[model samples]
Target chain A: MLKLRQGQAAIALVCVVLGFMLAVQFRTAQDIRSSIPFQRIEDLSQRLSQTEKERDVLLKQVYELRQTTGAESATKESENIKMGAGVVAVRGTGLSITIDDSKRLSKPGENPNLYLIHDEDMLKVINELWAAGAEAISINGQRLIATSEVRCAGPTLSVNNTRYSPPYEILVIGEPQTLENSLKMRGGVIETLQFWGIQVSLKKQDIVDVPAYKGAFRFEYAKPIKDGGK
Target chain B: MALPLVGLIIGISLGVFFPLTIPVEYAKFMSVALLASLDSVFGGLRAGAEEKFDNTVFITGFFTNALMAAGLVYIGEGLGIDLYYVALLAFGLRIFQNLAIIRRYFLRK
Candidate 1:
């Protein structure tokens, strides 16, 4: 009986170690599955897709409204105002520009960030397009309006509060030949971008479509001042 | 037997309450160690049932086997040879054999 008791103590100690390890291993496996970075990425992608679906539905409604509205002079004037305000999608012969990060590897000791597309680079391209008389402009399907902003949100570009990853596709509605000449001019935006190994491709298409702005226009602070007696 | 079962429950609850976490990189090593310790426990149980339990041998074997299994995994990662499978297969086979022997010993008694 004494011998049995001694053996039982040894077995009990070993069992303790085994049980502890088993619990820890189970917890570790569960931790790996729900790691913070993995969960964050999944959540972000789900929100992105949801917002895109919502935009598509709103775009369909815009087209339906345009179709249902009769050809009266007042309705025609409102349609023109909507087009100018970038609230309605437009299609015309224009230029489609694609800008992406450089595929070329940087030399040792050089800054790798130079190869990436920056907010300023995109802003410069948009400014050039506007100067060349682009009637409408959209980047990665997000339209540019009077209140639209082009800013950097970490590694991604945020246009009008919506974030997009490269390669950025800019669609414009204008005279294709004129737009192309302005961008491809000597020592222009394209040449500057190419010098740092950034990839820029400009295509002159017969028809280019730019999506309308999907965000709301809030005027809570600034009431429109009457030019004269209303 | 009841004492060992109670010890196991205590150990599991202790681990749960400690809030300790190992990094993801060392998880593989922890798994190998867990397998080794499990195999040792069963081997010790079988020896005890057969009336041949040695305290020194049981304790040393438990530590040495767990450490060696973890070392093998580390070496395998360095050499890029995947020696983890070897340790796993050996320990797995031993656990089943020890369980069967313990079961037979109880049946005969």
Candidate 2:
């Protein structure tokens, strides 16, 4: 009887180990799925389109009202400036930074793929630029929003709808000096990228027009729950 | 002596089975529900086991630990953190509780 009980105990221990392992695997799978970026960008794009339409209609109404009332021209001009600042498309003062793989790091004996920039490298740059207070950013013409997913799609990184090869060029529109200084700030993005043998360049122009964000932001599959229960 | 052990086996089996179909978010909630149900069922088993069955104190101790599991799940969901951490907590606590029960049973004999 003691031998039988001991055998049962051993089987029970095996079950516990297997059960714990299965739970770990399931949790990891769920975490990776949640980290994917595409869904967030899609949601942000929808919001941008909605805000733009609302602003346009309101501006037209303000103009019509001013014309009939013959109010001070200063008031109209001020309104225009404020509205322009709010939804005004910016044109001028932009800097572009390009990242490419380092050729020096590659050799005949070692991996020839040494020059490729991984996803995390790009993410770091993007995060730094945002911290520098960049008003708008684009990667190869794909506009980035708050929810944009910057991830590796195979060999290329896809931002919004566009994908590009090595030597990714990221463009930002904001105050020229501030944007340039932001990139060059200590720790600093430029110094860090150079260490990795990635190319970093900053060019500031007077007429840099950051385009209004164009994307669809809607979540069809996700629903918020009050209390998490089965 | 055997009934409570069978109850535990049955409980753990249900834990493994119920989480298969649900999303990770709901699987977390179900984990808490399963532990709570196990506690209640074990309570009934302890009443019957009386003399031969042991480790009643350790089994009941699992209830206090269940709250910690439930708390971790709530914090994870509230913060939009991945559900894996919550699963980690639940599995860890269950294993600890099991060990405590086993230790009590063996030491008493």
Candidate 3:
């Protein structure tokens, strides 16, 4: 009985050791990796820039109401209504990228062969979306944050701990023309993915509303470790 | 297992006597194995002797590895030695520790 107890204790100890070592290693490594500009600052700056954009639809509506209403008593009332509705949160328009497995569109040396999306590919799209100045972005309804990490587990891509499969629809609500052009412009992501035989497409929508970040933005016990310079 | 133990001893000796001769890169990688093994063997011993392994000890072991790595880097900067080289020294020590565990406890299984 004593010997058996000792054996079990040894196994438990190994688990604890492995878990502790790996957790610390991962935490510190992630810190150093994120501190680099390519990871943290760039994404934050992009999100900030997107948030600060304000479209003065109210101003335009007021101008039109004034010209049409003429010198009427209700003209002021009409202007007020226009102003209220005009400030109704301006949303951007753009193409939504739906990445999925091309199980049906199989060819020579191409995508969907594994019937899955790789983490690197997801990273590419995320990076491109930021570059395109996407106002708001989400993947399958999960709002992305600065610390969000896309990691691969077997065939699935785990975003912030939630596993997602192919046909990963990335919705970006931004200026229709600018967003579409950004995705399809020369030397752009579409072309790069095209080479890999991955499907690339774009479509203009009347209104593309990308939702605000929904997940908790809680970060515990981690802060920037000095400026560290670029 | 014996060869790894011998390597660990050599690493410790070189670090103590002709520290400058040892390449920092090699030492850093070696440290990972050493530290990992030390973590494992001690873990097993604790389990064998004590009814349960202490969480505090395991956490501290991890913290020690991290501090050593970071401290070594800072020290290297001050001494005009490559920070990476200092990391290698820690790694070398870890390798020795790991070898000791593997030869005594791990291989016996």
By lDDT, the best candidate is 1
Candidate 2 ranges with C-alpha deviation above 4 Å: A1-89, A107-114, A221-230, B1-109
All candidates: TM-score of chain A: 0.66, 0.53, 0.50
Q: State which candidate has the highest DockQ.
A: 1
What are the RMSD figures for all models against the true structure?
A: 17.6, 18.6, 22.1
* Candidate 1 per-residue C-alpha lDDT over B1-109 given as tens digits, one digit per residue, 9 for 90 to 100: 7878887998898777778767665778999899999999988888887788899999999999999999999888657678999999999999999989877877776
How accurate locally is residue B42 in candidate 1, as Cα lDDT from 0 to 100? 89
Q: What are the per-model numbers of colliding residue pairs?
A: 0, 13, 10
User: What is the per-residue lDDT of model 2 for residues A1-230, given as tens digits with 9 covering 90 to 100?
Assistant: 11123233333333343344345445545644663464356436645764796699889878777676556666876766643433344555678778877754443355655456777888888877775556677777666765677888888887775677877877777666766765664345665666545677767777655554567656799777869856
Best of the two (2, 3) by lDDT: 2
Measured against the true two-chain complex, the DockQ scores of the candidates, in the order shown, are 0.27, 0.03, 0.06
Off by over 4 Å in 1: A1-74, A227-230, B1-109
Write one digit per residue (lDDT tens) for candidate 1, span A103-204. Answer: 866656679899899999999999988976789999999999999999999999999999999999999998788688667654468867887779999999
